[model samples]
Target: MQKFGNATIEILKDETLSKNWYHLRNITYNYTNSKGETKTLKREAYDRGNGATILLYDPKIDSVILVRQFRVPTYVNGYHGWLLETPAGLLDGDNPADAIAREVMEETGYKLRDTRFLFKSFMSPGSVTEVLHFFAAIVDATDRVEEGGGAAHEDEDIEVVVIPLADAMKMIEDGDICDGKTIMLLQWAALNRASLTQ
Candidate 1:
């Protein structure tokens, strides 16, 4: 990466820390400060590739679709394991829209016809090298074709949840919905409901 604004970055070393389903790399870089001082820093970044997430909303019913499942990371961090989140998964060589559509079908049992691209963000930029593309889709009753709880081989046991948009926003305040990406999408929906419905 080239110098940006007041800092210059140079990669000194990049070593793979782990390689299983995903990759973790330990990176050492030299940072040249504005004062021309160079400092070396090391950090480990988890690279699970890029991912996509989508929130499915039904304007006719004023509701949204979400999923609940056990998250080991959240469990180990002292909260209950189960998390309510929008359907999402890694791109895995597929385009963002295709990956999100597949994930939505697999996790929520809904085949999306048209999806609106919202934005992209880094969920955990400080330590993880993952960027997530966010999307929103309008859906109705006809979209559900099968019971989706994720693939059997993937070992994902997800529970589909459909709730009113108002209730979901309340859940965020009550700490029931805590996933970062989910929260962002919900807030976006709340703010742009009229336009989104149209």
Candidate 2:
């Protein structure tokens, strides 16, 4: 690949701010705009690697499975700590499909099969270096092998929630399901219900 346009980027300094679970880097760079104006900027980016998320929909019953758990960031932002969201997790070196399968089983107790790739998105492109791969899988009663409440060792306390697809949409309008990835997947499901049901 070749660099496009007349803009140029130069890194001035790179500093590691934190490296607990993931890594946080403070970077200073000089970006020359296409108009030949150069600006030096400093920004901190949190690199949690990339992750995958999946929406488990049972088209036969017009229902979807989601999970609720406490999110510290949300809690500190003035909202309730618990959020209803689709099953998702860090890739942890696994492929997106494999990671989603493992996370789904761990969070919702369902073995996912035939996961259809939907799309990829940068949930927070400004400060987080995370590209989330999205997928959807059809599942039914037979797939539930255990009562999943997230991984005990990981301190994940998740509550499984199953509701009609219509109701899930209502929750979105009612400000109940406010998670970005969950909302995006639900909208996709609504737009592709007929084909997805088949």
The backbone clash count of each candidate, in order, is 0, 0
Cα RMSD, each candidate: 0.9, 1.4
**lDDT of each residue in 44-69, candidate 1, tens digit only:** 99999999999899998999999999
Error of 2 at 107 (Å): 0.5
Candidate 1 colliding pairs: none
Q: Where does the lowest 10-residue lDDT sum fall in candidate 2?
A: 1-10
Error of 2 at 88 (Å): 0.2
TM-score of each: 0.97, 0.96
TM-score of 2: 0.96
Question: Which candidate ranks first by lDDT, i.e. highest?
Answer: 1
Tens-digit per-residue lDDT, 48-166, candidate 2: 99999998999778999999999999999999889999999999999999999999999999987689999999999999999999999999988999899999999999999999999
